[model samples]
Every structure is written in structure tokens, then in C-alpha cells.
Target: MSETISPAQFHRAPGVTDWRVTGTGPQAVFAARSLGEASGLVAPVVAAAERFGVRPDVDVRPEAVVVRVPPGPDGIPAAATDFAAAVSQAAHELGMTPDPSRVQSVGLYVAQHSAADARPFFVAALGYEELGDTDAVDPLRCGPQLAFNPITGDVPSRGRTHLDVFVPADQAPARVEAALAAGGRLVDDSYAPAWWSLASPENHGVDIASWTDTTD
Candidate 1:
């Protein structure tokens, strides 16, 4: 076993604690206060995740180093090096050399599912007005509104992500009924005088939470 060192013997590296990584897949990238101001590049980290398909497991620190991918034939030297080089160029544009060590992006993807007959529930029942439609990323609309996209496959096993939409203190029940009348199946009815959860038949769930200020 290697010998353990004490705090007095620790060495510090310059620019070590200065970056953040986020996201996964093709969208992976790094973020920092600024790039000259940044000590590294962003793309390689994304590339690493894309090629390796796994992110580093982190533990033991507020600022963690997550190696977003594992080494293998897919993440061979050539790809890794190329990704690093791309990161270098990106850094140069920002007035610095590449530091592949730091990369990440913050992003979220929500998959909305609905029936071919999804409109009335969103429009009439939910009291949501249609915003507009665009083909660039399929139709996206917001609702006092629950906008859904038609999907043709087995329903997902479980929801990986969910949103908690807090209703106005007095509007909770109305919102819940609107959801129900519109064919949104209800799954749970228990509440702690604070919040309740509702799930659609398809298992898309939402939590209606009550807001309370401390002065109470």
C-alpha cells in the first residue's frame, strides 16, 4: 500500500478548483466563470461521455471530478486525444489552451406523452391556452396547461424525472380536478395538509405542493 501523507505535506495545483461539468450525451460541456478566466476546454468532457457512455462516480467533495466516461475500445487514445484537441481549440478561441480536465453543461429534457386525442384535456379541462406550435423541436406549449406529445410505444416503466408545480394556496383542488376531468388519471390521494400527488393512468406524475412561509 502507498504511504499516507498528512495535511502539512499536501501540494496544491494551480487552477485546480475552478470549473463545473454538466449534462450527458451529445450535449455534454463545461462551464466556468469565463474561458480566459477559464483554465480548460469544454467539448472533450462531452466527447468523453458520448463515447464512453458513463460518467465518473463522484464522492468526498463539494467540487467533484466526474470522469464522464470509462476507457475502452470506444474511448481509445485517438478519440480521447481528438476530443482533447477540440477542447484545446475551443479554449484558444476563449484565449487559453485546452484543459480537457474540465467540461460540462446544464440541460434538461422532458418527454411528454399523450393520446392522439390530447387537445381537449389540455385546452378545455386544464384551462390552458395554446401558445403556438413549431416544428424545430416538435410542438411545445405551456399550460395552466399540460402539453403532451403523442407517443407510440410501451409506456415508460417509471418516470425518471418529475416536476412539482405548486398551486396558489387556494387553487390546488381546482387544478387537480381539471387534471382529472381531462383524463389525467389520479394515482395518490394522501396529503399531510401540505401537498398531494397525482399520477396519470400512464404513470406521468405530478406533485401539487402547498407553500408556507415561516412566519406562520
Candidate 2:
């Protein structure tokens, strides 16, 4: 399992609902009815973040804008909360819904006989920068984080890698059902609420998970 960041470390302000903290920092996704709305959000959101002195990674999708606020020097948690608040207010004023529940982060897991030997190839191929020894992350924060897992024995016939999708706790059940409807087979669900491991029609593994304990 990857290292888990405690929920207490991700402080949320009063008006900022649905923002989540991951390995990256506090992240929120606002839903736009169309591409036009998504585009329209850029200027105001950027302006708001700048006003708060926070550098945010803003990804404009066809129907959403994914915002990731990086931890700051003074206090990462507080900074993240402030940044989220500003962005949330901007989004709400623009008729956008703070559907952070729909926000998801994916990480690519590559199982290798020797992680060191395999790491360089992926980093160079994807033009991804290294995040410590075992992971490579996209500098622009648009792509998924790549994690190298070392396997002891013979590699599996299916593949050496899989995808892990992290969603908000409340959305996991619906996500799992949708995956099943799409012909995905449940591999394991004993870890319920933490993660649900499933295999695609092609037998590729995809684990839908919640990074924080959201039972509360």
C-alpha cells in the first residue's frame, strides 16, 4: 500500500465543501454544463487563486475544471484550505457546482522484478519527473502518478501494471456499480470503503479506492 496522508492534515474551511486531499494536496473539481462553462471558469478561478497567493494546477476538461492547490511554505494545510475556499467561491458565483465527489485521481502501478531497472525507461518515455525513488509524476499534474512496485517472483501473465482510481468516499459504490456494468469483474471487495479491486474485461486490474477514512 502507498503511504496514506491523514485527513486531519487536510483542513477545510467553512464554505469550501467537497475538496479533498491526496498525495498531491487539496484538490477540487467543479462541474460545468458545457465546454464553454469550463473555459469561462479559467480566468476567474486563476484570478482568485492568484489573489490568495496560491499557485494552482488548473486542468480544463470538456465538462469540468480540476484544481489542485500545492502546499505552501507557511502552513500547507491552512494554505490549501484558503486556496480551496477562494476557488470554491469563484466557482459557485459562476453557476458551477462543486462536485468534488466526482473528482478522481489515478495512479499507474507497474510491477517490476527490479524497480530500479524499470524506473528510468518509464520516466524517460513519459517525460515524467521523478517523485522520490518509486514514483514518477507529471510535472503539469494532468497525468496520473506512476508508481513502481517490486515483485519477487515471476511476473504475472496478464501484465505488470494496473491503474488505481481514487474517488471521494461517497462515490465509491456508484463507481463500483458502473464498473461492473461495463463488464468489470469484482476481484475483491473485502477491503470495502478503503478499496474495491476489480478486473476489466481484458483482466487488467483497476482498484477504486478512497484515500481517507470517510466513515465519519
Candidate 3:
């Protein structure tokens, strides 16, 4: 297996300014003017991955082409930086620029005393694969990862399950503000730029986490 790299190292890699180390892996979004143009990027991205012998998940939309380096046990492979850089360079050749504002990912979290005990149920119910011992991931990777968060004493008032929204660091504050303006209340900001937990008007739980992909 190739060596694994830390998020910090990935961020510092050359030609990867367009990429971000998200909760799951290194990802980037290149903005395109049309669906045809976006689709044009798919082959080049796949070619880069083939050249590097790495797998990348690419999503083409009308306005953007997103490429994500699939992560391994420890983290993403060191070669992921090369893949990301190659993809970025190819997008640049097409007159596409990376859009940090559009780069984000989401995950589901379950608060419980025993993460292991609850793992099986979610795995069976959602048809997800076990990620290590206490987490589960969607096999198709189309859904958010579900992680079990341990709690000791009291159950959170918001509920047992919550959503963790991972956005670019620069876009985090505005995301929190918009949630609050839309009837959500700030439950906690003790973590500041790391994360801010909020409760919807109906008492659902969500955490805005922004610690990923930053240099601080």
C-alpha cells in the first residue's frame, strides 16, 4: 500500500490549492459553465487517477465537477496529492476555476453510551459497511457517513442522532448565521471555528464543523 499522508501535508502539496481535506478525504470542486463542460472533466480526472493508480470519485453537475480522493484506514494516500494536483491542472486547462464555496460534505452522528453495540443496527438498517468498529459508511458513498458519538450521562436534548455539516473554513460562519436566521438556535459555540452545535426550531440536532482543510 502507498504511504498515508496527514491532512496538513496534503494541504501543503503543490498544485492542490483547489483541494480541501474534508472529513472523509481530499476533495475539490471546479466550476464549469455548462453540464457538457462539466462532463468533459470526467475522463481527464479518471485518466489522472489511472495514471496515479488511485481511485477518485467524480461528480459532474451543470455548474461544477467535483473530485474526491477516496480515503483509506489511516487517511488518504500520499499519492492523493498528486491526483488532486493533476485534476486541478486539467481543470485549469479547460478554463475552469476551483470554487471553495461549493466544497462541503456532510455526516450523520449518533450519540450513545456504546458505539460498538449500536454499530450493527445502523449497519443492517442502512445497508452500510462497518467503518472500523464504531462507524459505518455507505457502500455507494452517496450518503453521509454515520459515526457513533459516545455520551456518558444524560442524553442530549436535541435527540440521539444529529447531522454534522462540513464546510470550508471561510464559509462556516455564514453557514451558522444562516441556520440561526432560519429558526435554528445556537446551542453551543464553545468550539468556535471547530464546530458549533445548533438546534432546529423543531428540536433536531446539527453541528456545523469547519476544522477540516485549514492551516490554523
Candidate 4:
């Protein structure tokens, strides 16, 4: 395995213009004409992974092909940059447009301040494994990763669990605008470009977050 690198470093590498650093790691989206066109990318993606000895997650949609390269325990490995570039090249060869706007990570956060231990219950119920100190992840990659945050139990208004949308810095504002127009109200934008906590019409909590300073 190559040395681990920061998100900014990976983003600045050549041929990664179509990629973004999500909550997990480097990911890219390519617009396709149809599912058939999207499916064509899988073979090339797998070949790239095999060449680099790293496994990448590929999701084919009717209009897009999303690829996520899982990071190492510490951070993204330098090898991922080359792998990402290969994927981007393959996408262009197929006449697909690189669309970084659609790349984002949707994670769940469970704020527990009660006395009883809830991690065990969640582990068994959700079939998750411990991911660092305050997070649980599905080994099968079936669902979004869940984070356990420390918060005051007295604040019922803050809610226990919330959806976190980790998107590219360049696309954060647009995403927030679309959500607000969808009937959700902004709870807090003090963190602007970093994150925005919003609430649905029913008061369900959701946050749009970004880590990169800019998309450059």
C-alpha cells in the first residue's frame, strides 16, 4: 500500500478534476446516456483496481456511474490518485461527462447522551463494525456510515439522530439552496461552506457538510 495522503493533496493531483473528497474518500460521478452505458464502466473500473491492487465501489445508475475508492485506515492512499485518474480516463473514452456535483456522502449521526450503553444495541441491530472511536460502519457497504456524537440529553429540540450530507465545497451552496426550496428550513448556516444544519417540514434534522476549502 502507498503512503496515506490528505484530501486536498489527492484533489490537486492530475486527472482527478472529476473527483471530490467525500466523507469516505475520493469519489467521482460520470453522466451516462443510460444504464447500459453506465454498466460499461464497471469492467474498466475493476481493471483499474486490479492493476493497482485496490478495490473500488462502483454504482451504476440510469443516468450516471458513481465510483468510490475506499480509503485506508488513516486516510487516502497515494495509489488512489492513479486509480481515480484511470477511471476518469475510461469515462471520457466512453463519451461520458464528468459530473462532480453529484458526488457526496450521506451518513447518519446518532447523538447519544443517555446513561445506558447503546453501541452494543446498534452493532447487533445494524450489523455494523466499530469504525474508530465514535463511528460504526457496515462492512458490506450496504448503508451509510453512522456516527455517535456526544450531546446534551436535555436538548430534545436537537434530536437524537440526523442525516449528514458531505458534499464537494463547490456544490455545497447549491445543495443547501435546493434543500431549502424543497420545504426544509435552515437551522444554522454559521458554518457556511463547512456545514449547514437544516430541518425538514416535520423537523427532521439534516446537515450539508464540506471539508475542502474550495474545489480548486
Q: Flag regions of model 2 displaced more than 4 Å.
A: 1-12, 22-24, 34-36, 70-77, 114-116, 155-159, 212-216
Q: Cα lDDT of all candidates, in order?
A: 0.37, 0.74, 0.86, 0.86
Give the Cα-based TM-score of candidate 4 against the true structure: 0.90
Per-model TM-score versus the true fold: 0.26, 0.82, 0.91, 0.90
Full-model lDDT, candidate 2: 0.74
Q: Compared with the true structure, what per-residue lDDT tens digits does model 1 show for residues 1-216?
A: 222221111112122222222112111123345433433333444554366343332211223222322222222222333343344345446554322333322211233443334454445644545433411111222122233444556365322434455433344567678878877866666763355667776876676544320002
Q: Which regions of candidate 1 are displaced past 4 Å?
A: 1-159, 213-215
The weakest ten consecutive residues by lDDT in model 1 span 134-143
Residue 123 of model 4, lDDT score: 84
| Lowest lDDT 10-residue stretch of candidate 4 | 150-159
Say what the RMSD of model 4 is: 2.5
**Model 4 regions more than 4 Å off:** 152-159, 212-216
**Model 1 pairs whose backbones collide:** 21-104, 22-104, 22-105, 29-104, 30-103, 30-104, 35-38, 56-67
